[model samples]
Target chain A: MDQLYTPSTEKCELVSASKGTVKFLLDYSKSLSIVKAEGMVFENNLN
Target chain B: MEHQTDDSTLVQDYISGDERALEILINRHNQRITSFIYSKVLDRDAAEDIFQDTFIKVIKTLKKGNYSEEGKFLPWVMRIAHNLIIDYFRKNKRMPKFEGGDDFNIFSVIGDEKPNVEKQLIKDQIDSDLSMLIDELPDDQRDVLIMRIYKDMSFKEISECTGVSINTALGRMRYALINLRKIIQKNNIVLTNY
Candidate 1:
């Protein structure tokens, strides 16, 4: 059983790491998005 | 116009008290964002509106304690923009096409510019070459690179968007970049020429 799943284990780790990274970006982008949106609004109002 | 602050620094400053950090980030990326959205919508006005909405979505998420500073930031916003465009299409039941891989097609919207004849000639050569190269790429490789570089999507989001596996997406990009390099070398054009 151990031999059968060893490669799968490594791949799972890779997938998990990638998933973690994606989650972080999603969260960070969510925070930064507001200012961007608001800035555009202010610019549009002036034009 | 330029990236006044690095993205990481901008985020940190925003977390503290600098009101302009967000503005800096927006200015740094707005042109890229605009072009990506324009690629999808093929309508300059609607692209501008979607561009605003994508940034707005980013801002609102940041304030609500939902932001996590992980992985590639540009790709995340790109995914949002892509989704919004897809949603827009769903509502209208229409899809846009790029005719004959014309890279300069987008530039027409930003016209009435002064003449810099020498520079324009160089730019025109590069644009035509790039368009030709892209048209010649294998469809899988071409599609992924367009989304990755042009639309600014990450492999994972692209997988979600296209229903392809992540490995497949990355593999396509790897081949695409290699093929593009070969094309550039064969044509004796610098990669930056595009």
Candidate 2:
């Protein structure tokens, strides 16, 4: 997971990025009845 | 003063093997892009699938050194998502079938039957023509028409999406149809074969 700062906040809090991307890839994998993207970009590429 | 990295810079960074840049870019636009897809598909799973597919295409294109949109990243992604949505509809053969309604029925205007190849060709032509006519409508009315007709969203869903009352959504839809008819007549574009 990549640590990124909040864009608009003044405090500059650290946050874990790619949560949505991970979930999206997981959902997509499930939809295709696959465990993961395998050799695709999302396989171990996301947090 | 805080400085924000623009999308083009982020794209370049991601292309240069900085995966964190891609994460930031995805996180930044996730909600808007996902919501836009969901509004069109009206299904969470399908929306997520399309979103994933959209990014997959983006990554491939970028990796292949074909990322030429530059500053206009979001619009380019949205266009890809829009085409994917059209593909989903085409694969499922789920064209809108409007129920009997008030003075105007959009389905009747753009006949959706594909009984023969000739009718299918005509329907395709009408769809192409209607897409152009739709572009001329006022933004609000166009939004309503797309949500109601293309997205197959109900008035309540349209109301929630547009942050307007259901009545307001319905009114916009009516006006959209009314104006669409007027535009067709004014332009002398025949939408129906009969």
Candidate 3:
């Protein structure tokens, strides 16, 4: 009896929450990539 | 040229003190790993901090010759990221309660308060965050979440399709909801109709 279940719009919001989080991560990773690339270029110039 | 390289090769190179290889590996898995952490914490600055911490741990573990899981480098690093997310929760003294030491059920704790027009933008932002986080869930849990939330499948049907017990499917859904609520609270997500 304790395990009865029901669905709500909140559940849908949960899915949306995860989707937005991943999108942010992808966007942030791009900035990190640019920084890494610049560092690599500098290192190559030094060598 | 680096695009054709596989993870194990990069891991071995890193173990041999080739920092460039580690950089390539990070570049390869950074988005997925970052997304996974952001899904749990839902804070950009916090996610970035944990992201850096995760890679620091990866470097230390590899340098110490303790990375035993060969050919599974990304998953290993992700495990580290997940653990750090859990550590963040524990450290903040806001860790979600788990049932039977497995499933985290926080639906009851999530307030049913409705947001007004003034908080519409904030609610929209939170909704977007939730969307991305769901994509980063572990395969099994994500599958259950998608089936239950998006596909609107019953736990019995989920078990039939995934070949797990009904209880396992139910547990996954519970954990999914709990994790979502935790991220929502941690990030100050404001729910509203828009």
Tens-place lDDT per residue, model 3, B72-143, is 887887888889998998987775543443464465457557665667767777678778878766778889
C-alpha lDDT of candidate 2 relative to the true structure: 0.75
For model 3, the docking class works out as incorrect
Model 3 / residue B33 / CA error / Å: 0.6
How do the residues B12-33 of candidate 1 rate in per-residue lDDT, one tens digit apiece?
6765656567666676677677
Indicate the DockQ of the complex predicted as candidate 3. Answer: 0.03
Q: What is the DockQ of candidate 1?
A: 0.04
Q: List the lowest-lDDT window of 10 residues for candidate 2 chain B.
A: B92-101
Q: What is the TM-score of each candidate against the true structure?
A: 0.38, 0.42, 0.40
Deviating ranges (above 4 Å) for candidate 1: A1-47, B1-4, B94-194
RMSD of each: 24.2, 22.1, 24.5
RMSD of 2: 22.1
Instruction: Report DockQ per prediction, comma-separated.
Output: 0.04, 0.05, 0.03
The global C-alpha lDDT for each of the candidates, from Candidate 1 onward, is 0.68, 0.75, 0.69
Each model's interface RMSD (Å)?
13.8, 9.9, 8.8
Best TM-score among the predictions, by candidate number: 2
Which candidate, 2 or 3, has the higher lDDT?
2
lDDT of 1 at A40: 51
Which digits, one per residue and each the tens of the lDDT, describe model 3 over residues A1-47? 64576443332222112344444433333323111353342111111
